[model samples]
Target chain A: MTHGTTSPHPAEPAPAPRRGRPRDAARDRALLDATLAVLAENGYGGLTTAAVAARAGVSTATLYRRWSSKEELVIAAAALHGESSYEQPGTGTLEGDLRVVLREKAAAMTGEPGRLIRALIGEAAHNTALAEALVTAFLQPLYDRVAEVVRRAVERGEIPPLDGVELLGEVVVGPVMTHFLLTPRLPEDVDQATARETADRLLPFALRAVGGTP
Target chain B: MTHGTTSPHPAEPAPAPRRGRPRDAARDRALLDATLAVLAENGYGGLTTAAVAARAGVSTATLYRRWSSKEELVIAAAALHGESSYEQPGTGTLEGDLRVVLREKAAAMTGEPGRLIRALIGEAAHNTALAEALVTAFLQPLYDRVAEVVRRAVERGEIPPLDGVELLGEVVVGPVMTHFLLTPRLPEDVDQATARETADRLLPFALRAVGGTP
Candidate 1:
């Protein structure tokens, strides 16, 4: 799991400590949790290193000592927050499984994890390292899981062996991402109802894209 | 010509200036052009109203006099920059015209306008008014143009008169937008070759989605 370009998290601590001993694993977890907490309450623009330190019960110097910049800190927090146990549902049919997977992904976007993800995406535009980390750690796994299902459908001859099946996620998840970013709806309002509606509407096109009769 | 929630551009000037007689149309154009220039050099994170005003040869107060906030200024700038003379290509085939239009849209993403567009997208994730403006001004026009091509295709019996042909842009343009934002490629490197390749790959899927044989 790529925590980020930097290794300041408990899961992957920095190799050499800048202090007397290696950074405390528990402290790293607290700091990351605090980072996410702050992100959840106040979007990226409101997140500050001092605020995070105060929330985590650590000094500002500790945070600066651990992470080089706020961008690095945010990316680390994003990766930590993004860790999920999303299992690919094997529903026999491509559309059925896609609806399940997409619904789950969409549901996740309604919570703190989703907000942080959006914040990270916004920040990533200006910050290259964060952008790369987001692609590698956050987006790539989700894409890989979606790609696996499409690969299986192709192997079963359920759909045509499309050349760009790998990009299925772009079509599958793009509209929801667009809606999340551009829509002025409250996050709670984008619940299972909205997710289901979008899934029902877009799944046919996704299935058809792979040459499956929707 | 939808200039956003707060229209300060000449195309759609503010309702009435907060002070003084109506704002100068030429100043609006200069500020918007300067906004794009600043955005091209520094992504959204670095964009500030002061920099934009300085670049446009105006005082920060002049900008504040017209627009309520920086978010409004950026969106108006984005809308002004996004104004294009792209006519719907009538190649008589859905795939052919889609390829033409998609290629044109993709090519635009390789320049300064594209950079500002991406910056606005990132910023929109947080700014509600900007988000609304983006969907209304930037995306809605582009979507309308693409939807027209699909409408024509349906009329000609080229594809099933499927509902939501209006959303063909989401499926068609989604992949390219995803690629443009997430990929860490230098703007100059995203040339005609990359644009053509994306257009070719996605056009097939887009056609299939609309029930047209690729």
Candidate 2:
């Protein structure tokens, strides 16, 4: 697969489609949905192009025409899932926006989506393709959203225009990632309440890290 | 496997040996060593009791006598590996000590031990034993060491007496972890110099998080 930001897969075309038959949005949606379903049940290792095709009621040729490999398919599916789950809550203040976003992020981690994510994390160690796909499809978009939040915060003078402010997403959510993903004995439910509380506690440190008045 | 801290296996008795032949420390050492070797080569799923026994030149019964399951044995081996790798540095200041510890921790993550850790993190999602063991054996001991450093810093007035100082380890290392474990595009070698630089950048934030003067 060609490296960098552009994904060669038909599902996520590198550029605008030329001609040929215009891409079927409905069929593409079905295939992506089927891919996630297979991943949720069978995990990254168990995911197969043939199975995804069968689940989508499409031929192997159709699946292959969109994605060259299972890795590309899984990545596209994960990206689609992330896009659907992610909501840009323009809550005015930086803290308010982050609180909503972080809560949603934490909830996703504890819910069904989290299972697929964990399975992917495990499989990524062995499959570089999957690892790259995870970062490109899942993490990049989330990072962009976080950067947008910080940008607004900077404009409002809540956060100082520090050099590391651009990378504040990692700093802000590092503790959450450590808690939800790395920590074994997670608290009950790991619901929106828990996420909100965690975000409240850690936000000051993140603010301070970016030279903001916490 | 019996629940809780106590091991039910004959080779891993809760108390001192009663009237049976004295347990061979050398043999136990060899078994643990063999277990890690197998893990480093075969990963968590591929590791087997038979393979470990064969590598250690011990009988399958002998291996099973100490640890009833593959999860238990891998946890013990990983615990042993973590213990050996973790070095406590009382370098006068909290920053100095953390710099050393975090640097070492980062280097380890980019090395052989990291592979096993990644594999376990993946497997632990589904396996409670592995998750519990990861927290108990690997994370707990390291957390203790980190807490000690913060305690000394607080006593010295470098950091204010804070309620959450006990969790400074998580905060100090959270960003490093987010960069190393979560990010796919790792820098070259993930060298000690880079680790130290990252620790330098994040330590002030950790200090500030605990109400310290950075």
Q: Which candidate tops lDDT?
A: 1
Question: Which stretches in model 2 have alpha-carbon errors above 4 Å?
Answer: A1-23, A84-92, A151-156, A159-167, A185-189, B1-23, B85-89, B151-156, B161-167, B185-189
Across B69-136, the per-residue lDDT of candidate 2 in tens digits comes to 89888987776655555667888987787777677677666655666677787788667778888887
Residue-wise C-alpha lDDT for candidate 1, range A121-149, written one tens digit per residue: 77766667777767776667777777888
lDDT for predicted candidate 1 compared with the true structure: 0.71
For candidate 1, give the docking quality class from DockQ. Answer: acceptable
Q: Write the per-residue lDDT of candidate 1 for residues B99-179, one digit (tens) a residue.
A: 887787777676666666667767776766777767766677777877888889888988877765655667666666766
Candidate 2: global Cα-lDDT? 0.69
Give, for candidate 2 chain B, the lowest lDDT window spanning 10 residues: B1-10
Model 2 complex DockQ against the native: 0.45
Residue ranges of candidate 1 with Cα displaced over 4 Å:
A1-28, A45-54, A58-73, A186-188, B1-27, B38-72, B164-166, B186-189
Cα-based TM-score, every candidate: 0.80, 0.83
Top TM-score model:
2
The stretch of ten residues in a row with the least summed lDDT in candidate 1 chain A is A1-10
